[model samples]
Target: MVKMLCDPVCPPPNLSQHPCCTVKCWKWDVNQITMNNLVKYGILILNRPITQNSGFIKNLWNRATIRMTVDGGTRQWDKFISGLSNEMQTTIKDPDLISGDFDSITDEILEKYKAKGCKVIHTPDQDRTDFTKAIMELNTHRKQTGLELSHIIAVAQTSGRFDQIVGNIQTLFLVKEELLLDPNTNVFLISDDSITWLLMPGDHVIYIPEETRQHKRAWCSLVPVGETCKYCTTTGLKWNLDNQSLRFGGIVSTSNTFDGSEKVTVKCSHTLMWSMRLPTIAIS
Candidate 1:
């Protein structure tokens, strides 16, 4: 039983902090079957990594109902087709929506997708990142249908300008803030080997599915990104947090090993991020 000493400004401590809360159980009210599975979520493929990726990319391709591309990501989609055989190319699905500042995507690709019944919405707002625009689109669509998205898997390569990579991380938090009241909305940054997502304030349990494990050990991390997470605790992790405060320039949980723990639980005083090394299995 992990007890919490809550910050005054933060809500009253979750009395139901795992083994002993009387008010509410600290468990997420989501179906265990869909937890960490991509089919239940949405996929937003950005240009870089998805464009340069193959094989492993085939694994997570068709799991989401909502599919969209960001800016040059459309160009990347068309480029991806170039690398596939005629049979493989026919199986590729164009995004339902292509959104961005209309800079990187080629006119040819736009014509192609539009011809295939895809909607292309161009926003000339240079004020925000294309990633942000894409997120806004998702938020709006979900709100209209009153459908809560299971999660978001953002596919983008970090092999770019230093600031761009940092901006991508910022995109995660920014979208969370935009959908401020929706606590269940999850956004994940995924590349080839790394996956990351924010663990908002309160209790969080990361369920390790059997399919996500390819070896005996996998690595996971928790870092206080926006503000310091005070009085945080975790279990089912090799180096468990014992009422620790995580922040930069201070103690942080990084490269922690997840050695066959079926469930990892975490509770924080404020919003923070949870990152982990994704399994390398080819999920066909």
Candidate 2:
């Protein structure tokens, strides 16, 4: 049976040792993850404007073991906190690091954060996007600090330029190799209305919050990336896939809603990009 819990408890056990075991559990409720527990997650803000739920962002910032911004993301972060109340602003911590090619961030904002003792990493690689470069920095930071960050949450948006969105998704595919992170290190992209991540070829269980499962408009999708998912099966979705093929020109699961099940199960033959619509969360 799949283990499911609302609170951030212990890390999932190693089921790989059991040849018949292939289940991996996932939980996305950052708000419930407290600092009292092990700091196993990091947060990265991309250049896209953070127009998502402020309270949700606040929880992520407060609970993150490492916080960073990429290029113009510095300006975006500054703008985000500037709108918060003085009391709220005081609760948020300064970013631990700021990195980019230094093209988008203004000198004033850059200096301000530097004055706050944030590390500045100048990455001028024209081949990689700032987002990808930021992940490289994250890997370096992990080596220097010896912090075991098992998960990475990147704050970005999906409504911007289409190419930028696709580029962000492409970065997910390169995370393990470029960042030199563990194969199990999960990376997620959170936008104004959704959370997206890559699902490797395996069995997976995604625990949905009760509120989101009941939300009338909540949706989820699984799209094959890079190559077609030759064999994909799912449960707990309004339209479950039964040994179906998912490809760009073939049958793709989009705008699919939940079937009121608290958890969804997926078994796939190849890497698939999974995304779920976030419920309307109250801003603090």
Q: Best candidate per TM-score, number?
A: 2
Per model, state how many residue pairs clash: 2, 0
Instruction: Report clash pairs, candidate 1.
Output: 15-21, 16-21
Clashing pairs in 2: none
Question: In model 1, what is the error at residue 226, expressed in angstroms?
Answer: 1.5
Query: What 10-residue stretch in candidate 2 is worst by lDDT?
Result: 2-11
> What's the TM-score of each model vs. the native?
0.79, 0.87
**Judged by lDDT against the true structure, how good is candidate 2?**
0.79
- Quality of model 1 by C-alpha lDDT: 0.67
Model 1 weakest lDDT span, ten residues long: 1-10
Whole-model lDDT values for every prediction: 0.67, 0.79
